[model samples]
Target: MSGDAPISTPWRPSKKDARYTGPRACVKCHAEESATQHLTAMGRALEPVATSEILRAHPRLTFRSGPYAHEIVRRGDQSLYTVTDGVNTISEPILYTFGQGKAGQTYIFRHDGSFYESRLSFYKDIQGLDVTIGYPREIPPSLEVAAGRRISMDEARNCFSCHGTGAAYGNQLQLDRLVPGVTCEACHGPGAEHVAAMEAKQFKDKRIFNPGKMSADDLSQEFCGSCHRSAEQVISNKLLRGLITVRFQPYRMFTSRAHDPADMRLTCTACHNPHENPSADEAFYDPKCFACHRSFASLKSPAVAKTEEKEGRTDKACPVAQSLCVSCHMPKVEFPGSHFKFTDHRIRIAKAGEQFPN
Candidate 1:
């Protein structure tokens, strides 16, 4: 038998009252929010390999990336992933499925009690397995443990902690105990005390951490930036430029002129609802921007519209395109290898045929 490994610091707060009660507890009171959140990408961020329909959708999933060949074989009740480096082969049962299969779905497999990410991912837009985002295309011949990135135990824990809820319990990475995706406790902290208070009809402070109540700087840096990389994190990691870095919305938004230090509503939650699935409609965000840029008083005026072609009625908004403000300011720029189009969060007036902003 093997000895126990050393325990690291706990991921969540050490407060005695902060215990997770799962998402079901929140459904009783916040039914609408909970129901809608369950449909979001964050809600289905992670799941067990067995629960993933993507794997079963394609019986024999295979892809070749550079010098390695990867395949996921379904064997009755189990799914086995095999990775080969031409001469060497390593096969393991797929343990977990990362992502919601919206952008992509990455697999995780265990070997020698350590977890490693599969090189190939099923991109929804592309509808095929390809090299995982930010991973090298060609793995070296010397590395034969897996046909993918061999992440450390700490890395594995961190990845799960972000993808799912209750991943870390008292300095231990308990994947089995994980709730499998971002649940109620992920953003609002643990809900055990809150549930108890609700049950007791106390109507007092439930000891739940609400990001909306935090200060502007704290809300942006510690709250939203907890998952979305903070300004400091992006700069520290040296991910300043390139299309790959566009995914770091907080860092980009922090650098934008729209982010006012004096205002609390200028944060990410201003445009995005934490409980709802993010919509792709560019016009949906125009009202959020117009709240700060243009006056609501203009919208109330029952004046002659442009569609009616009324003479002497000039619109104060953008002369060219008015409604879809995001399509012009926050243009969707395609990354080199990704099929998904990432809207630049650095809110700026983009010139036509201009290079991507640095």
Candidate 2:
């Protein structure tokens, strides 16, 4: 999403033979989400760095000017630009926050030792020009110059089989890390088929499964709409790259009517604690209305049992107490790389003209 590939096969990672098999080596029963949620970006994007953490502070910096092998991607303080040099090279398109242009994003080059697919800068500035934000299917300005056609690990196993983590798709493919952008076996399953069904204790999944054992209210909201709901496009017309990965179902709260809760055991990790930080900590907000609405005389709705008996508070509330219960139902929403405080998991009602939904 940064480099400009159109010079004839400079981007790489195809013809399979890939491999990343690192981190959990078959997850080992999620082992506390492989260190607080598959190691971090809240779930997956590019972790394998650390040559002394990229030589600390560019310690003498120089992957030989540039062509590839000198890294650095960080967003909110400006850092883009990586390289392993051609057959897939990245670096450029910096703007962690400046009107959030650069249509979502797409930077993952690295090639042979693993990383694939790059180039997706579909443009965005709208009222200021350079439009074309990948509508129905515009990309054909000749595949928008990604080192002239090089994104192919089948265009990156459809966005790395769910933002990658311990993926091993054969004929040569191996990943164990990609940065923390998605994890817990990416929607839970491939820890080498549940670590060989838990060491023959004849394992019935020692943990993390059972969407109430899927009793079907449309298979528990399609097990979180397979990634928060935005399907159909099947192939072509670009658009797709691990949007906060799993349980974002239908993607980014897919028209979230508070994520369709009539309480079919309402899930999305139920008020989301997907390993942490969607502003959690109401002892993990409303476990299905605090397990049947936490006995404010069993709340059959006397105005939500008098607002939980006038916020008497639970387990001792105070999560920045707006009478806790998740500070008046999922609040905050500062946006723009978050240093300004970001919130908004869609659990709504802080309205004012479609106000702050970014």
Model 2 misplacement above 4 A: 1-103, 111-120, 123-162, 167-184, 187-190, 193-268, 272-358
User: Candidate 1 residues 1-358, lDDT tens each?
Assistant: 0011213212255343347888998998988888788768888888776767777777788887566677888887678988777787888998888886555688888876677887678888867788776665555544453366677767777787778887776556777668888877877767788788878988877667677777776777666777777777777765456666688788888888767665665677777888887778877887776555533344555543432224322325454565878878888888765667877889888899987766
For 117-146, candidate 2 gives per-residue lDDT tens digits of 333321122211121122222233322242
TM-score of each: 0.86, 0.27
Error at 237, model 2, angstroms: 38
* Candidate 1 colliding pairs: none
Candidate 1 whole-model C-alpha lDDT, 0 to 1: 0.71
> Candidate 2, which ten residues in sequence have the lowest lDDT sum?
3-12
Per-residue error (Å), model 1, residue 307: 23
Q: Tell me, what's the RMSD of every candidate?
A: 6.0, 18.1
- Candidate 2 to truth, TM: 0.27
